[model samples]
Target: MLLALLGVAAFSLTFPSTAWGLESFGPWSLVALRGVLAALIAGAFLLAGRVPVPDRRHWAGLAVVGGGVVVGFPLLTTLALRTSTTSHAAVVVGLLPLTTAAFAALRTGRRPSRAFWLAALAGAAVVLGYTVRESGGSLSTGDMYLFGALLVCAAGYTEGGRLAAVMPGWQVIGWALVLCLPLAATGAVTALAVEPVRLTAHGALGLGWVAAGSTFLGMYLWYRGMASIGIARASQLQLAQPLLTLVWSVLLLGEELSPAAPVAAAGVLMCIALTQRARS
Candidate 1:
């Protein structure tokens, strides 16, 4: 439960750092650099801790989870924010719990209760309405990428939760970091090719957040939470993250709050309540 509780706070720090990373390179480059650094840190821990090697089955999962959650989600979401506003991205990401919940239901064939469905539906509606109000155009390339990233991340979260059920905190994420290195290297090359990124003090600080808080610490906590509380309950804690991001954006970036803040907050709160009730 504590793990679930901390998920939002961890993610809150990570997502905003996405903006910080872009100060140097494009989203992909930032992802590439961050991934390499995270992998190195995790690799050092693995060596120091004597972590076990992956079996074949572990490899299969490591591949998908690495591609889907670690790489795909951050990459897409960062790219989306390059064009879209922070609130716009926040509203969509606020629905991640609903996506994870739906995936859990599909995977387990466990029927969601009426309130679960109702809250999920209402949350989606609120997100859509918020998007329409903020971004008047039809879904852009960035939106599709963000949505796909969310779906891939949902799958990864579910699986990572299961991995946490057995593995040590460092091991599960260490393995993820280990498996993600190759692609991250490729992403780094790609990022440099496109953006020619350089490190100013702010860029370095931003990457520091990406390296430590966002990837290393945030991911570990998220997995620990999922491990302890189960994905169904833990994922619900994401409700706080978007709201927190909105608050941060307003305070830090001087972005104006939309009039619909109350409705969006209500939607997220209602969903969190319904998910909590179902879990209990």
Candidate 2:
């Protein structure tokens, strides 16, 4: 639980960080560079630890992690950030915990208790209501991207959790990042050539944190937590992530904090507590 909370903390900073990153980098370049940088960091850890290659059976799972996590989520979210505010995007992404729980159930054939499902659904409802109210019941292209990100990221999280049961959690993400290295490198090069660049201190720091902190270390802790608890239970911890992100947006990005944020936070926290106590 501590590990999962830590992971959520790391992820909460991602949207604001991406906003900073966008001050200098185009959406395509930012996403591509993020993948490449994170891959390099993951590669270093794997090589330094002398991690053995994953078995054939794990390759398919790793590929899913590579495509969904290392590529799809970041790309889609970064693109979304181009038009949407960090606070808005964070609220929409609050649905991730529920989505991931559903994916885990389907992938692992494990059924969480009725209480768990109810709590998860309650949390999702809070997020959905907040999102709809915030957006005036209108969905934009950026929302579309974020919605797509939710599905792909949920798939990745489920697969990563499963893989972590058989391997070390860090190695699960480490190898998945390594698997996507070639593609990331190519994308980085191609996107850098086509996209405009205007580097700043904020951009460099944002990029660094997303790569090293969010992508690798965050995932390592998350998978470990999921492996410790069941994925569905652990995923419920993320019910607080959007609120955290909202706070970060105010603190870091200077975004206007919503009046309802506190109420939503309280609701989400209650749901998380219920889900955590519920049987899996």
Candidate 3:
């Protein structure tokens, strides 16, 4: 839970950078650069620490974790955010726990207690209901895009967390960074072909923060928590993120939104707590 919180914090801090990078360079460009830089950052740490290469026993898991979480997630999210506000994206992203819990139960053959199931469902219902109400009974295109990204992200979180359990947190993310190489390269190439960029000083600084904080540190800890605990438990931490994201959006984006943030937060949190207490 501590690790998950750290990951969430890092993500929140860098959340503003996403809009900046997107403005300077499109989402794919930012994602590609983030992947390449994150890999380099992790690799540098590995070399500095002289960490031994992971045994083959862990390779397949790393591949799945890294590919699913690192490469797949960034790409999908960047595309989703192209049309979505960070607040909108955060709402869908909040569903990670519900999705992961379901996946965990299916994978481990562990039967979550009835209370756990109800709480999880209730949380989803609250969030979905609120979203529809806020949007005045219409879901926007951006919402749908983010919803798709969240589905992909849920797969990454569940699988990556499972692998992180046995592997060291840094190693888990490191492996994912490794998996990102080819895909990132392809993305970078495509980005260059379409909209090549040379960052201004401000842009460079933003990218640096994003690489160090969000991609490297944030992602590393998230998978660490996921691996150490089951995804179902780890995902519960995310219930708080959408609220935080809304706060950030109001502060940063200057968007006046629902004044019922506290109520919504409490509802989501209650559901998370209920599910956590109910889970086997």
Candidate 4:
């Protein structure tokens, strides 16, 4: 639980950081550069630690982790944030825990209790309500991108959680990063070729945070927690992420906090706590 909370704390800054990066970088550029940078750092860690590579059978699972997290989630979320506010993105992303739970069930055939389901549903409803209210009661293209990001991210999280049981959590994410190296390198080079970039301090800071913290370190802690506690329960911790992100959005991006924001956060947090306490 503590490890997972640490991961969530790291992740909570991502949306606002990405928003900051988008000021000077194209969404694709940011995503591509971040992925490549993360992969490089992860590769260095693997090399320094002398970590053995996974066997052939596990390579497929690693690919899923890489594709969903190193590729899809970052790309989709960056695209979404191009047209969305950090707060809007945070509200939509608040559904991630429920999605993660659903994916965990599918991946592991672990059935949560009725009480857990109810609490998860209630939390989802609160987040959806917040999203709709923030977006003025209508869905937009940003929402679609965010939804896509959630699905892929859930799959990656579930798969990584499962693998973390038998492997070091850091190695799980590191291997995924190495697996993504070629593609990430290609994308980064292509993005740079197409659009030249002049990096500002803010953009560099945001890029550094997401590439290092979100892509590798946070995932390490998150998968470790999931391995220990199981995915369904660990996912409940994600319930607090949006509230944290909202706080960062206000502080970093100067976004106005709505009165309803805290209310919805409190409601969702209660449902998360209920789910956490319910029998699995």
Candidate 5:
């Protein structure tokens, strides 16, 4: 539980960091370069540990994990944040616990109780309602990107949790990043060739935070905790992430909090608690 909470705490800073990073960096450059940086760090970790190469079957799982997290989520969220506030993005991403639970069910072939479904549906309704109301009854492009990021992130989280059950948690993310090093290198180079990257001190620090903390360290703790606690129950911990993010947004980005934010947070959190109570 401490491990999971630590991981969630790390992740809760991602949106605000990305928003800060965007002040000087292009979304594409930030995403590509961040992956390249994380890959290097992961490579160093594996090399020092003298980890054996993964098998062919493990390669497939690593690819899925890398594609969703190392690429899809960061890229999409960066682009989404180009138009959306950290607060808005945080609220939308608050739905991740339910999505992660759904993917965990699919991966494990377990059916949650009907009460779980009801709680999940109610949580989804609350999130969707907040989204629609916030967006003036139509989904913005940013929201669409966030939704895509949500699905891909859910897939990554579920797959990584599965992998962690068989391997060290840090090694799981490290190898997953290593498997995509070639592609990440190519993307980073290509983005650089297309446009120049301008990084202020703050932007550089923000990029480092996401690459090191969000991309690698957070996954290590998260996968380890999930492996220990079971993904379904571990996912319940994510319900607190958005609230932390909202607090960070207010502190770091000086974003104003809406009264609706806390109310909606409470509603969704209640639903999450109900879902957690329903066993398989």
Candidate 6:
């Protein structure tokens, strides 16, 4: 739980960091560059540990992880941030815990207790209500992108959690990131060529955090925690992530905090407590 909470803390900063990154980079460029940089960092660890290539059967799962977390989620969310406020995007993504739990059940064939599902649903409802109210009860193009990100990221998180059960958590994400290197490199090159670049301190710092801190370190801690607990249970912990992000947005991005934020946070935390106590 400690590990997972740390990972959530890292992720909570992603939107604000991406906002900083956009000060100098186009959405495509930011995604591609972060992928490449993260892959390189992962590769270094793999090399230092002299990790052998994973079994052939594992490659397919790793591919899904790469495609979802490394590519699809980052690309879509970054694009969405082009028009969406960090707070708005954060609330929309608050649905991730429920989505991830559903994916875990489908993929792992392990049903959590009824109480768990009920709590998860309640948490989702709170988040959904907060999101709808924040957006004036209407969806936007960015919401579409955020919803897409939720699906893909849930798939990635589920797969990564499963793989982590059989292998070291770091190796799971490390190999996945390495597998994405060629595509990331190609995209980075093309994006750098096409997108205008105006470097700033915030942009550099943002790129650094998203790549190393969020992508690599955060995933490492998250998968490890999932392996220690269980995927569905660990995923429930992410119910707190959106609240954390909202706090970060207010502190780091100078965004106004919604009055409903504290209420939503309290509700989500209660749901998380219920899910944690429920049997699997």
Candidate 4 lands at a TM-score of: 0.98
- Relative to the true structure, candidate 1 reaches a TM of 0.91
The root-mean-square deviation over C-alpha atoms between each candidate and the true structure, in angstroms, is 2.0, 0.8, 2.2, 0.8, 1.4, 0.7
Instruction: Name the candidate, 2 or 4, with the larger lDDT value.
Output: 2
Candidate 3 C-alpha lDDT tens digits along 2-90:
88888887777555667667767777788888888888888888888787887888777677666656666666666767777777677
- Could you give candidate 5's per-residue lDDT for residues 1-280 as a string of tens digits? 7898899999999999998888768888788888999999999999998999887788888888998889999999999999999988988987888899899999988777889878877877787788788888898999999999999999999999999999998988999898778888898888878766676887888899999999999999999999988787788778778889999999999999877888888987798688768887
lDDT (tens digit, per residue) of candidate 1 on 1-280: 6766665686776656777677777777888888899899999988987776967777776666677667878788888878876766877787788788777677646566777677667766777777667667477776777788789888877777777777765567678877899989987987688787766766777778877776777778888887776676777778767788888777656678878887788877787777677633
**Better structure of 1 and 4 per TM-score:** 4
TM-score of 6: 0.99
Q: Which ten residues in a row have the lowest lDDT in candidate 1?
A: 271-280
Q: Given candidate 2, what's the lDDT at residue 3? A: 93
List candidate 3 segments past 4 Å from native.
Answer: 196-202
Per-residue error (Å), model 1, residue 91: 1.1
Q: Which window of ten consecutive residues has the lowest lDDT sum in model 3?
A: 12-21
lDDT of each: 0.75, 0.92, 0.74, 0.91, 0.88, 0.94
Q: 223, model 6: CA deviation in Å?
A: 0.4
In model 5, what are the clashing residue pairs, if there are any? none
Candidate 2 matches the true fold with a TM-score of 0.99
Q: Rank the candidates by lDDT, best first.
A: 6, 2, 4, 5, 1, 3
lDDT for each residue of candidate 6 in 19-61, tens digit (9 for 90 to 100): 9999999999999999999999999999999999999999999
True-structure lDDT of candidate 5: 0.88
> TM-score of each candidate?
0.91, 0.99, 0.89, 0.98, 0.95, 0.99
**Where does candidate 2 clash, by residue pair?**
none
Least lDDT summed over 10 consecutive residues: which range in candidate 2? 257-266
Superposed Cα deviation of residue 224, candidate 3 (Å): 2.7
How far residue 34's Cα lies from its native spot in candidate 4, in Å, is 0.6
